[model samples]
Target: AQSVSQHNHHVILSEAASLELGCNYSYGGTVNLFWYVQYPGQHLQLLLKYFSGDPLVKGIKGFEAEFIKSKFSFNLRKPSVQWSDTAEYFCAVNPRLSGGYNKLIFGAGTRLAVHP
Candidate 1:
């Protein structure tokens, strides 16, 4: 079955550190990529998303993701991260289906711990 993969299981960083989390999917067709973050005791929030326009999509909280179609990757990046950025980051992909309703497949998720 098609799935998403996050290379980093856990990442520890100090405040203002640069961050990059690798995310790859196993599908080769048209897709919509997304980055979701779930903070401690908080609901999931959309960090960034990529559809049909730009390959590089910017999302909330200073987070951005580049959709590399050739590599089948949509890696999330941040030039500087703050302690408040501590959360579980998940990479999700929605493969285009016949009926235009496809369930999102998410990665195992990368737990980010930012220290002050």
Candidate 2:
């Protein structure tokens, strides 16, 4: 079993400000990590994910994440953020299991506020 942890519960930033959200997982075996975002009144959308191959992956909306195996982390980063970026971010991990089925364990979530 694995759990996800997000370092920052909430974050505030201004337009053009750089953004970084920390995420870590507990499982040590083959796993898949994802970053999901939910706007003020929208469904959860995938931001980025890391499964295999390259450690770094880029997702929609200028979002990117680096998977550091040693740290068991997949932190999200954006060089410059916009007011539209205001949303709740979540980190999730999917552990490999038998029967070819797995469930995602998500973090508490980080609420982001962007000011103009």
Candidate 3:
């Protein structure tokens, strides 16, 4: 079965601290990986995506992720985080199928708390 999983359900950090969230997916074939963030009272926004080219991809708001094929994982990382970064993070994937647009399968959710 194809699925996505986020290890951390919630996280707490102080301002200017580093952040890393674990994300793992189950898929044997080609897939598109993505990290989406949803701030308080806001719609989900794309943080980063790994499509075809490079394995390491960077996204908006100083977020980055490295796609490890062998591990079937694409973990998000930020060297420094702010209180404004507090939000919910969801790891998603689009599995390639026969036809039609691929649908995004997201993990449960991860709540990030950044203290000032």
Best candidate, TM-score-wise? 1
Q: Tens digit of lDDT per residue, candidate 3, span 1-116? A: 78999999999999999999999999898999999999999999989999988898999999999999999999999999999999999999998876858799999989999999
TM-scores of the models, in the order given: 0.97, 0.96, 0.97
TM-score, cand. 3: 0.97
Residue pairs whose backbone atoms clash in candidate 1: none
- Give, for candidate 3, the lowest lDDT window spanning 10 residues: 95-104
**Clashing residue pairs in candidate 3 (N, C-alpha, C atoms within 3 angstroms):** none
Q: By TM-score, highest first, what's the ranking? A: 1, 3, 2
Off by over 4 Å in 2: none
Residue range 1-116, candidate 2, lDDT tens digits: 57899999999999999999999999878888899999999999999888799998999999999999999999999999999999999999998777656588999999999999
Candidate 1 local lDDT, 1-63, one digit each (tens): 789999999999999999999999999789988999999999999888888988999899889
Q: What is the lDDT of candidate 3?
A: 0.94
